[model samples]
Target: MSEIPPFEIIRASRRSISIQISKTYGLVVRAPFSVPEDIIHAFVDRKSDWIMKHLARHTEQRERKNNTLYYLGHIYPFEYNLLQKETVTHSGGMFTFSGKVKDSGMEQAALTRWYRKQAQIYLSERVYHFSWKHELKHRKIRITSAVTRWGSCNGHNDLNFPWRLLMAPKEIIDYVVVHELSHTVHKNHSKYFWNLVESIIPDWKAHRRYLKEEGWRYALPKF
Candidate 1:
Protein backbone atom coordinates (compact mmCIF):
# COMPACT_ATOMS: atom_id res chain seq x y z
CA MET A 1 0.00 0.00 0.00
CA SER A 2 1.28 3.45 -0.94
CA GLU A 3 1.36 6.11 1.74
CA ILE A 4 -0.52 9.31 1.02
CA PRO A 5 1.10 12.46 2.33
CA PRO A 6 -0.62 15.10 4.46
CA PHE A 7 -3.55 16.73 2.68
CA GLU A 8 -6.45 19.02 3.45
CA ILE A 9 -9.91 17.63 2.86
CA ILE A 10 -12.84 19.97 2.34
CA ARG A 11 -16.43 18.81 2.47
CA ALA A 12 -18.65 20.64 0.00
CA SER A 13 -21.75 20.20 -2.16
CA ARG A 14 -19.81 19.15 -5.21
CA ARG A 15 -20.90 16.02 -7.08
CA SER A 16 -17.53 14.28 -7.35
CA ILE A 17 -14.27 13.99 -5.44
CA SER A 18 -11.44 16.00 -6.91
CA ILE A 19 -7.73 16.27 -6.07
CA GLN A 20 -5.69 19.42 -6.41
CA ILE A 21 -1.99 19.99 -5.83
CA SER A 22 -0.81 23.47 -5.04
CA LYS A 23 2.45 25.00 -3.94
CA THR A 24 0.73 26.93 -1.19
CA TYR A 25 -1.70 24.21 -0.10
CA GLY A 26 0.14 21.04 -1.05
CA LEU A 27 -2.39 18.25 -1.62
CA VAL A 28 -6.09 19.09 -1.31
CA VAL A 29 -9.16 16.90 -1.60
CA ARG A 30 -12.61 18.27 -2.28
CA ALA A 31 -15.59 16.01 -1.89
CA PRO A 32 -19.31 16.03 -1.38
CA PHE A 33 -20.52 15.67 2.20
CA SER A 34 -22.12 12.35 1.20
CA VAL A 35 -18.73 10.70 0.71
CA PRO A 36 -17.57 8.78 3.79
CA GLU A 37 -14.22 9.40 5.40
CA ASP A 38 -12.96 5.96 4.43
CA ILE A 39 -14.04 6.47 0.81
CA ILE A 40 -12.31 9.82 0.63
CA HIS A 41 -9.17 8.44 2.20
CA ALA A 42 -9.11 5.48 -0.18
CA PHE A 43 -9.61 7.73 -3.20
CA VAL A 44 -6.79 10.01 -2.15
CA ASP A 45 -4.56 7.07 -1.32
CA ARG A 46 -5.09 5.70 -4.83
CA LYS A 47 -3.88 8.95 -6.31
CA SER A 48 -0.84 9.38 -4.06
CA ASP A 49 1.60 8.86 -6.92
CA TRP A 50 -0.11 11.44 -9.12
CA ILE A 51 -0.24 13.81 -6.18
CA MET A 52 3.51 13.50 -5.59
CA LYS A 53 4.26 14.06 -9.28
CA HIS A 54 2.22 17.23 -9.48
CA LEU A 55 3.61 18.55 -6.21
CA ALA A 56 7.10 18.31 -7.65
CA ARG A 57 5.99 20.00 -10.86
CA HIS A 58 4.36 22.85 -8.97
CA THR A 59 7.48 23.44 -6.92
CA GLU A 60 9.65 23.63 -10.02
CA GLN A 61 7.23 25.95 -11.77
CA ARG A 62 7.00 28.24 -8.77
CA GLU A 63 10.75 28.51 -8.40
CA ARG A 64 11.08 29.20 -12.13
CA LYS A 65 8.46 31.93 -12.14
CA ASN A 66 10.00 33.62 -9.13
CA ASN A 67 13.70 33.57 -10.04
CA THR A 68 13.88 33.76 -13.80
CA LEU A 69 12.84 35.78 -16.84
CA TYR A 70 12.19 34.76 -20.45
CA TYR A 71 13.31 36.36 -23.69
CA LEU A 72 14.17 35.15 -27.19
CA GLY A 73 12.87 31.65 -26.20
CA HIS A 74 15.40 31.28 -23.37
CA ILE A 75 15.12 31.61 -19.60
CA TYR A 76 17.64 33.85 -17.85
CA PRO A 77 18.25 34.81 -14.27
CA PHE A 78 17.69 38.49 -13.50
CA GLU A 79 20.54 40.79 -12.50
CA TYR A 80 19.82 44.16 -10.93
CA ASN A 81 21.61 47.27 -12.06
CA LEU A 82 21.84 50.52 -10.14
CA LEU A 83 23.07 52.58 -13.09
CA GLN A 84 22.86 51.89 -16.80
CA LYS A 85 22.05 53.74 -19.96
CA GLU A 86 19.05 51.60 -20.87
CA THR A 87 16.05 50.64 -18.77
CA VAL A 88 16.40 47.02 -19.96
CA THR A 89 19.08 45.30 -21.91
CA HIS A 90 19.89 41.69 -22.87
CA SER A 91 23.46 40.63 -23.24
CA GLY A 92 25.60 37.50 -22.78
CA GLY A 93 22.51 35.31 -22.32
CA MET A 94 21.15 37.32 -19.38
CA PHE A 95 18.97 40.37 -18.70
CA THR A 96 20.33 43.34 -16.78
CA PHE A 97 17.78 45.77 -15.40
CA SER A 98 18.56 49.30 -14.25
CA GLY A 99 15.59 49.61 -11.89
CA LYS A 100 12.98 47.64 -10.02
CA VAL A 101 11.79 44.88 -12.35
CA LYS A 102 8.94 43.58 -10.23
CA ASP A 103 6.44 44.56 -7.51
CA SER A 104 6.39 48.11 -8.83
CA GLY A 105 3.89 49.79 -11.12
CA MET A 106 6.53 52.08 -12.59
CA GLU A 107 8.73 49.16 -13.63
CA GLN A 108 5.79 47.40 -15.27
CA ALA A 109 5.03 50.48 -17.31
CA ALA A 110 8.66 50.77 -18.38
CA LEU A 111 8.79 47.11 -19.38
CA THR A 112 5.65 47.44 -21.48
CA ARG A 113 7.01 50.45 -23.29
CA TRP A 114 10.40 48.81 -23.92
CA TYR A 115 8.92 45.57 -25.22
CA ARG A 116 6.42 47.39 -27.44
CA LYS A 117 9.22 49.42 -28.93
CA GLN A 118 11.19 46.29 -29.72
CA ALA A 119 8.12 44.49 -31.07
CA GLN A 120 7.33 47.40 -33.36
CA ILE A 121 10.84 47.38 -34.82
CA TYR A 122 11.36 43.62 -35.06
CA LEU A 123 7.89 42.52 -36.22
CA SER A 124 7.76 45.26 -38.80
CA GLU A 125 11.05 44.13 -40.30
CA ARG A 126 9.89 40.51 -40.49
CA VAL A 127 6.56 41.56 -41.98
CA TYR A 128 8.30 43.53 -44.68
CA HIS A 129 10.76 40.73 -45.38
CA PHE A 130 8.04 38.12 -45.80
CA SER A 131 5.70 40.44 -47.69
CA TRP A 132 8.38 41.12 -50.28
CA LYS A 133 9.50 37.49 -50.54
CA HIS A 134 5.94 36.27 -51.11
CA GLU A 135 4.60 39.38 -52.83
CA LEU A 136 1.98 39.83 -50.07
CA LYS A 137 0.62 43.34 -49.73
CA HIS A 138 -0.45 44.96 -46.48
CA ARG A 139 -1.28 48.47 -45.38
CA LYS A 140 0.72 48.76 -42.16
CA ILE A 141 2.16 47.10 -39.07
CA ARG A 142 0.87 48.04 -35.63
CA ILE A 143 2.19 47.03 -32.20
CA THR A 144 -0.42 46.57 -29.51
CA SER A 145 -0.43 45.96 -25.76
CA ALA A 146 -2.99 43.18 -26.13
CA VAL A 147 -3.48 40.69 -23.34
CA THR A 148 -5.80 38.07 -24.81
CA ARG A 149 -4.30 37.55 -28.28
CA TRP A 150 -0.97 37.44 -30.07
CA GLY A 151 -1.88 39.08 -33.35
CA SER A 152 -4.76 40.14 -35.57
CA CYS A 153 -5.37 41.15 -39.21
CA ASN A 154 -8.12 43.56 -40.13
CA GLY A 155 -10.04 44.22 -43.35
CA HIS A 156 -7.88 47.31 -43.81
CA ASN A 157 -4.94 44.94 -44.41
CA ASP A 158 -3.22 46.31 -41.34
CA LEU A 159 -1.58 43.79 -38.99
CA ASN A 160 -1.55 44.09 -35.19
CA PHE A 161 0.75 42.16 -32.85
CA PRO A 162 1.15 42.11 -29.11
CA TRP A 163 4.31 43.60 -27.60
CA ARG A 164 4.73 40.57 -25.34
CA LEU A 165 5.60 38.44 -28.37
CA LEU A 166 9.09 39.93 -28.44
CA MET A 167 9.82 37.75 -25.44
CA ALA A 168 9.59 34.68 -27.65
CA PRO A 169 12.47 33.44 -29.76
CA LYS A 170 13.08 35.03 -33.14
CA GLU A 171 11.76 32.00 -34.98
CA ILE A 172 8.55 31.96 -32.92
CA ILE A 173 8.20 35.71 -33.57
CA ASP A 174 8.62 35.10 -37.29
CA TYR A 175 5.95 32.38 -37.21
CA VAL A 176 3.44 34.78 -35.66
CA VAL A 177 4.24 37.50 -38.17
CA VAL A 178 3.73 35.11 -41.02
CA HIS A 179 0.51 33.83 -39.46
CA GLU A 180 -1.11 37.27 -39.28
CA LEU A 181 0.14 38.20 -42.71
CA SER A 182 -1.38 35.02 -44.12
CA HIS A 183 -4.72 36.49 -43.06
CA THR A 184 -4.23 39.17 -45.67
CA VAL A 185 -5.12 36.52 -48.24
CA HIS A 186 -7.31 34.12 -46.25
CA LYS A 187 -9.34 35.53 -43.42
CA ASN A 188 -10.51 32.14 -42.16
CA HIS A 189 -8.73 29.01 -40.93
CA SER A 190 -9.47 26.93 -43.99
CA LYS A 191 -6.97 24.42 -45.43
CA TYR A 192 -5.90 27.15 -47.80
CA PHE A 193 -5.04 29.39 -44.85
CA TRP A 194 -2.88 26.80 -43.13
CA ASN A 195 -1.37 25.69 -46.42
CA LEU A 196 -0.11 29.21 -46.98
CA VAL A 197 1.39 29.30 -43.49
CA GLU A 198 3.07 25.96 -44.09
CA SER A 199 4.48 27.23 -47.37
CA ILE A 200 6.50 29.86 -45.55
CA ILE A 201 7.22 27.93 -42.36
CA PRO A 202 7.24 24.21 -43.04
CA ASP A 203 7.45 23.52 -39.29
CA TRP A 204 4.66 25.92 -38.46
CA LYS A 205 2.92 23.31 -36.34
CA ALA A 206 5.81 23.21 -33.86
CA HIS A 207 5.83 26.99 -33.51
CA ARG A 208 2.07 27.06 -32.92
CA ARG A 209 2.43 24.44 -30.21
CA TYR A 210 5.20 26.46 -28.58
CA LEU A 211 3.01 29.53 -28.41
CA LYS A 212 0.03 27.62 -27.01
CA GLU A 213 2.04 25.81 -24.36
CA GLU A 214 4.55 28.54 -23.52
CA GLY A 215 2.51 31.70 -23.97
CA TRP A 216 2.22 32.10 -20.21
CA ARG A 217 5.83 33.21 -20.09
CA TYR A 218 5.05 36.19 -22.29
CA ALA A 219 3.89 38.58 -19.57
CA LEU A 220 5.28 41.52 -17.68
CA PRO A 221 5.65 41.28 -13.92
CA LYS A 222 2.40 42.27 -12.20
CA PHE A 223 2.12 45.86 -11.09
Candidate 2:
Protein backbone atom coordinates (compact mmCIF):
# COMPACT_ATOMS: atom_id res chain seq x y z
CA MET A 1 0.00 0.00 0.00
CA SER A 2 1.12 3.59 -0.64
CA GLU A 3 1.70 6.11 2.17
CA ILE A 4 -1.23 8.49 2.41
CA PRO A 5 -1.05 12.21 3.20
CA PRO A 6 -0.79 13.26 6.82
CA PHE A 7 -4.11 13.73 8.62
CA GLU A 8 -5.74 13.23 11.98
CA ILE A 9 -7.79 10.17 13.00
CA ILE A 10 -10.21 9.84 15.87
CA ARG A 11 -10.53 6.23 17.09
CA ALA A 12 -13.31 5.07 19.34
CA SER A 13 -15.70 2.22 20.06
CA ARG A 14 -18.10 2.16 17.12
CA ARG A 15 -19.31 -0.01 14.25
CA SER A 16 -18.53 1.69 10.93
CA ILE A 17 -15.78 4.22 10.18
CA SER A 18 -16.02 7.53 8.34
CA ILE A 19 -13.66 10.05 6.71
CA GLN A 20 -14.04 13.80 6.29
CA ILE A 21 -12.24 16.66 4.58
CA SER A 22 -12.68 20.03 6.24
CA LYS A 23 -12.41 23.49 4.74
CA THR A 24 -10.00 24.92 7.28
CA TYR A 25 -8.75 21.69 8.94
CA GLY A 26 -8.32 19.37 5.97
CA LEU A 27 -8.81 15.58 6.09
CA VAL A 28 -9.91 13.58 9.14
CA VAL A 29 -10.91 9.98 9.72
CA ARG A 30 -12.96 8.66 12.63
CA ALA A 31 -12.57 4.93 12.97
CA PRO A 32 -13.41 2.13 15.36
CA PHE A 33 -10.79 0.59 17.63
CA SER A 34 -9.80 -2.23 15.27
CA VAL A 35 -9.32 -0.31 12.03
CA PRO A 36 -5.69 -0.09 10.98
CA GLU A 37 -3.97 3.02 9.56
CA ASP A 38 -3.43 1.37 6.19
CA ILE A 39 -7.07 0.39 5.90
CA ILE A 40 -8.25 3.85 6.92
CA HIS A 41 -5.99 5.55 4.41
CA ALA A 42 -7.29 3.18 1.73
CA PHE A 43 -10.85 4.16 2.58
CA VAL A 44 -9.99 7.85 2.47
CA ASP A 45 -8.28 7.51 -0.87
CA ARG A 46 -11.30 5.70 -2.23
CA LYS A 47 -13.66 8.49 -1.21
CA SER A 48 -11.42 11.52 -1.73
CA ASP A 49 -13.75 13.04 -4.31
CA TRP A 50 -16.74 12.99 -1.98
CA ILE A 51 -14.58 14.46 0.77
CA MET A 52 -13.36 17.33 -1.43
CA LYS A 53 -16.85 18.22 -2.52
CA HIS A 54 -18.19 18.41 1.02
CA LEU A 55 -15.21 20.39 2.19
CA ALA A 56 -15.57 22.93 -0.58
CA ARG A 57 -19.23 23.42 0.07
CA HIS A 58 -18.70 23.79 3.80
CA THR A 59 -16.01 26.38 3.21
CA GLU A 60 -18.19 28.34 0.83
CA GLN A 61 -21.06 28.47 3.29
CA ARG A 62 -18.79 29.55 6.11
CA GLU A 63 -17.32 32.31 3.98
CA ARG A 64 -20.77 33.55 3.09
CA LYS A 65 -21.86 33.65 6.73
CA ASN A 66 -18.64 35.36 7.82
CA ASN A 67 -19.75 38.58 6.18
CA THR A 68 -22.62 38.96 8.65
CA LEU A 69 -22.20 40.46 12.14
CA TYR A 70 -24.37 41.43 15.09
CA TYR A 71 -23.39 44.91 16.11
CA LEU A 72 -24.74 46.55 19.25
CA GLY A 73 -28.03 48.50 18.96
CA HIS A 74 -29.31 46.18 16.25
CA ILE A 75 -32.66 44.50 16.90
CA TYR A 76 -33.01 40.75 17.39
CA PRO A 77 -36.11 38.71 18.15
CA PHE A 78 -36.97 37.43 21.62
CA GLU A 79 -39.64 35.05 22.83
CA TYR A 80 -43.10 35.86 21.39
CA ASN A 81 -42.82 39.23 19.62
CA LEU A 82 -40.73 41.01 22.26
CA LEU A 83 -37.59 42.47 20.75
CA GLN A 84 -34.35 42.47 22.70
CA LYS A 85 -34.23 45.93 24.26
CA GLU A 86 -30.70 47.40 24.24
CA THR A 87 -30.35 50.05 26.91
CA VAL A 88 -27.20 51.65 28.39
CA THR A 89 -28.40 52.90 31.72
CA HIS A 90 -26.42 54.81 34.31
CA SER A 91 -26.04 52.79 37.54
CA GLY A 92 -22.79 51.25 38.76
CA GLY A 93 -21.33 49.31 35.80
CA MET A 94 -21.83 46.20 33.65
CA PHE A 95 -24.84 45.13 31.51
CA THR A 96 -28.48 44.62 32.51
CA PHE A 97 -31.70 43.30 30.96
CA SER A 98 -35.24 44.61 31.23
CA GLY A 99 -37.93 43.55 28.71
CA LYS A 100 -36.21 41.34 26.15
CA VAL A 101 -32.71 42.40 27.21
CA LYS A 102 -30.56 42.66 24.18
CA ASP A 103 -27.67 43.98 26.27
CA SER A 104 -28.12 45.37 29.78
CA GLY A 105 -24.97 46.97 31.10
CA MET A 106 -24.98 46.37 34.84
CA GLU A 107 -22.03 44.04 35.47
CA GLN A 108 -20.38 41.33 33.38
CA ALA A 109 -20.26 38.74 36.18
CA ALA A 110 -23.93 39.07 37.06
CA LEU A 111 -24.92 39.22 33.42
CA THR A 112 -22.96 36.06 32.60
CA ARG A 113 -24.63 34.15 35.42
CA TRP A 114 -28.08 35.30 34.29
CA TYR A 115 -27.31 34.35 30.72
CA ARG A 116 -26.17 30.88 31.78
CA LYS A 117 -29.36 30.28 33.75
CA GLN A 118 -31.51 31.39 30.84
CA ALA A 119 -29.55 29.16 28.44
CA GLN A 120 -29.88 26.16 30.74
CA ILE A 121 -33.66 26.33 30.82
CA TYR A 122 -34.11 27.27 27.19
CA LEU A 123 -31.50 25.02 25.52
CA SER A 124 -32.24 21.95 27.62
CA GLU A 125 -35.93 21.82 26.77
CA ARG A 126 -35.24 22.25 23.08
CA VAL A 127 -32.54 19.58 23.19
CA TYR A 128 -34.90 17.21 24.96
CA HIS A 129 -37.67 17.67 22.41
CA PHE A 130 -35.46 17.41 19.32
CA SER A 131 -33.47 14.47 20.63
CA TRP A 132 -36.64 12.59 21.49
CA LYS A 133 -38.22 13.29 18.13
CA HIS A 134 -35.14 12.11 16.24
CA GLU A 135 -34.45 9.29 18.71
CA LEU A 136 -30.93 10.64 19.10
CA LYS A 137 -28.90 9.57 22.11
CA HIS A 138 -26.64 11.93 24.07
CA ARG A 139 -25.13 12.02 27.55
CA LYS A 140 -25.49 15.40 29.27
CA ILE A 141 -26.02 19.06 28.38
CA ARG A 142 -24.04 22.04 29.67
CA ILE A 143 -23.63 25.79 29.16
CA THR A 144 -20.33 27.56 28.75
CA SER A 145 -18.63 30.65 27.26
CA ALA A 146 -17.13 29.55 24.01
CA VAL A 147 -15.11 31.96 21.88
CA THR A 148 -16.16 31.04 18.35
CA ARG A 149 -18.60 28.14 18.45
CA TRP A 150 -22.22 28.34 19.59
CA GLY A 151 -22.42 24.66 20.58
CA SER A 152 -20.30 21.53 20.45
CA CYS A 153 -20.55 17.79 21.16
CA ASN A 154 -17.80 15.71 22.68
CA GLY A 155 -16.98 12.10 21.93
CA HIS A 156 -18.78 11.15 25.14
CA ASN A 157 -21.91 12.66 23.56
CA ASP A 158 -21.96 15.54 26.04
CA LEU A 159 -23.31 18.77 24.55
CA ASN A 160 -21.89 22.20 25.40
CA PHE A 161 -23.83 25.35 24.52
CA PRO A 162 -22.66 28.93 24.78
CA TRP A 163 -24.68 30.97 27.24
CA ARG A 164 -24.58 33.92 24.89
CA LEU A 165 -27.12 32.21 22.69
CA LEU A 166 -29.75 33.73 24.96
CA MET A 167 -29.08 37.03 23.23
CA ALA A 168 -30.61 35.68 20.03
CA PRO A 169 -34.19 34.74 19.20
CA LYS A 170 -35.84 31.53 20.34
CA GLU A 171 -35.85 30.19 16.81
CA ILE A 172 -32.11 30.80 16.50
CA ILE A 173 -31.62 28.99 19.77
CA ASP A 174 -33.60 26.04 18.41
CA TYR A 175 -31.44 26.08 15.30
CA VAL A 176 -28.30 25.71 17.40
CA VAL A 177 -29.87 22.80 19.23
CA VAL A 178 -30.76 21.03 16.03
CA HIS A 179 -27.34 21.74 14.56
CA GLU A 180 -25.55 20.26 17.56
CA LEU A 181 -27.85 17.23 17.71
CA SER A 182 -27.19 16.61 14.05
CA HIS A 183 -23.57 16.12 15.06
CA THR A 184 -24.65 13.09 17.08
CA VAL A 185 -25.57 11.35 13.85
CA HIS A 186 -23.00 12.77 11.45
CA LYS A 187 -19.87 14.20 13.04
CA ASN A 188 -18.97 16.20 9.97
CA HIS A 189 -20.64 18.59 7.55
CA SER A 190 -21.10 16.13 4.74
CA LYS A 191 -23.89 16.18 2.17
CA TYR A 192 -25.87 13.45 3.87
CA PHE A 193 -25.50 15.19 7.21
CA TRP A 194 -26.83 18.51 5.86
CA ASN A 195 -29.68 16.61 4.21
CA LEU A 196 -30.58 15.16 7.59
CA VAL A 197 -30.50 18.64 9.12
CA GLU A 198 -32.77 20.01 6.36
CA SER A 199 -35.25 17.24 7.03
CA ILE A 200 -35.42 18.34 10.66
CA ILE A 201 -35.33 22.17 10.38
CA PRO A 202 -36.46 23.23 6.94
CA ASP A 203 -35.87 26.95 7.62
CA TRP A 204 -32.35 26.50 8.93
CA LYS A 205 -31.14 29.08 6.44
CA ALA A 206 -32.99 31.93 8.16
CA HIS A 207 -31.81 30.75 11.55
CA ARG A 208 -28.28 30.64 10.23
CA ARG A 209 -28.66 34.15 8.86
CA TYR A 210 -29.78 35.32 12.27
CA LEU A 211 -26.75 33.71 13.80
CA LYS A 212 -24.29 35.19 11.36
CA GLU A 213 -25.74 38.67 11.70
CA GLU A 214 -26.98 38.79 15.28
CA GLY A 215 -24.73 36.12 16.70
CA TRP A 216 -21.58 38.09 15.89
CA ARG A 217 -22.44 40.75 18.48
CA TYR A 218 -22.89 38.24 21.32
CA ALA A 219 -19.49 36.79 20.55
CA LEU A 220 -17.84 40.16 20.96
CA PRO A 221 -19.46 41.18 24.25
CA LYS A 222 -17.13 42.35 27.04
CA PHE A 223 -18.43 39.58 29.24
RMSD of each: 3.6, 14.4
- The best candidate by lDDT is 1
List the candidates' TM-scores in order.
0.80, 0.52
Segments of candidate 2 deviating more than 4 angstroms? 1-106, 219-223
Cα lDDT of model 2 by residue, 51-164, tens digit = 765665555456534222221223332221234543322133223234454333433444466667867888888999999999878889999998688899888889999887
Residue 90 error, candidate 1, Å: 2.4
What TM-score would you give candidate 2 relative to the actual structure? Answer: 0.52
Model 2 misses residue 14 by how many Å?
54
In angstroms, the error of model 2 at 115 is 0.7
lDDT of each: 0.81, 0.69
lDDT of 2: 0.69
Put down candidate 1 lDDT per residue, 89-165, tens digits, no spaces: 76787766676333456556666787788788888899999999998889989998888898999998899998888
lDDT score of residue 135 within candidate 2? 89
lDDT of 1: 0.81
